[model samples]
Target: MVIPPPVRPPRITEFLKPYVLKMHFTNKYVHAQVIHSPTPTVTASVSSQEKALRSSMGITRDVAAVAKIGKILGERLLIKDIPAVTVFLKRDQKYHGKIKAVIDSMIKAGVKLL
Candidate 1:
């Protein structure tokens, strides 16, 4: 009997491209990070839970808070010389509500989303 070859898992670089923009939302905070796929390293990150952000935000988790996190993340990425990224939304999160708010703020902050 002939046997089929085993399938290999796809490389993160194969689909994640050069860099990935990751976002996560919890009941109490929103977080975002820019990762370099090849090196598998986080280049920049921001969260509503950060002490400075929290002090400025008052409300830790909300669309506004998420937007602030996104804007800050985008700025950090820019500072790190990452101008573009592929957005990776965690789990079953949809492109609405806080997610949309974050993405919009990122775009406004001048980070190109692929």
Candidate 2:
């Protein structure tokens, strides 16, 4: 007998659309910011394109790149005395993969996800 695939419940974001802070790191660029949240609240962020970690890591792909961004974000949080924060993994329709690696880095750095 063949087994059927399990059905997953709709994502929380699909309904709640929680506030998201995100950053994108690529071979040549890094963009970071907060999204869908209230105004006047600056979600301190950093990225490779900001010249901080853009050239810090030689390898830009997979876990290497993800680790670099995680370090940057962690540093920023540390400087602000923020012990932990909720993170929304944003990859524009892409799930798991490198995104998972990035989230892992955040967790290791002491981030609390909602």
Candidate 3:
């Protein structure tokens, strides 16, 4: 019997080394950190999944949701003394429409995806 090779998780460091990575999920959450580092050391992050925001804006397929996540992420990053990051859109999704809108918004708000 033949067996398949073990699947490897997407490595963020492989793409953006020596810099902070701001990875946003399709869900309401955004996770930011330096690659190959521990979770507690996350540079910044945010999510509409938070209690207050979740009640006002339940999960929905609207550009506003993505934008809000971006804004929240930007604010958190600012507070953490991180002024910029390399936006790593996880899972190989194309950058268009809602994602593009959110990314643009982040740039405007000072995320600086590069």
For candidate 1, what's the RMSD?
A: 5.3
Best by TM-score: 1
How many Å off is the CA of 73 in candidate 3? 0.5
TM-score of each: 0.82, 0.60, 0.62
Candidate 2's TM-score: 0.60
- Which candidate, 1 or 2, would have the higher lDDT against the true structure? 1
Instruction: Record all residue pairs in model 3 with backbone atoms less than 3 Å apart, i.e. clashing.
Output: none
Q: How many residue pairs clash in each candidate?
A: 0, 0, 0
Q: Is candidate 1 or candidate 2 better by TM-score?
A: 1
**Candidate 1: where is the Cα deviation over 4 Å?**
1-16
Model 3, which residues run further than 4 Å from truth?
A: 1-40
Q: Where does candidate 3 have its weakest 10-residue lDDT segment?
A: 31-40
Compared with the true structure, what per-residue lDDT tens digits does model 3 show for residues 33-92? 333243335655555556777777756446777777677767766676666665556677
- Index of the highest-lDDT prediction: 1
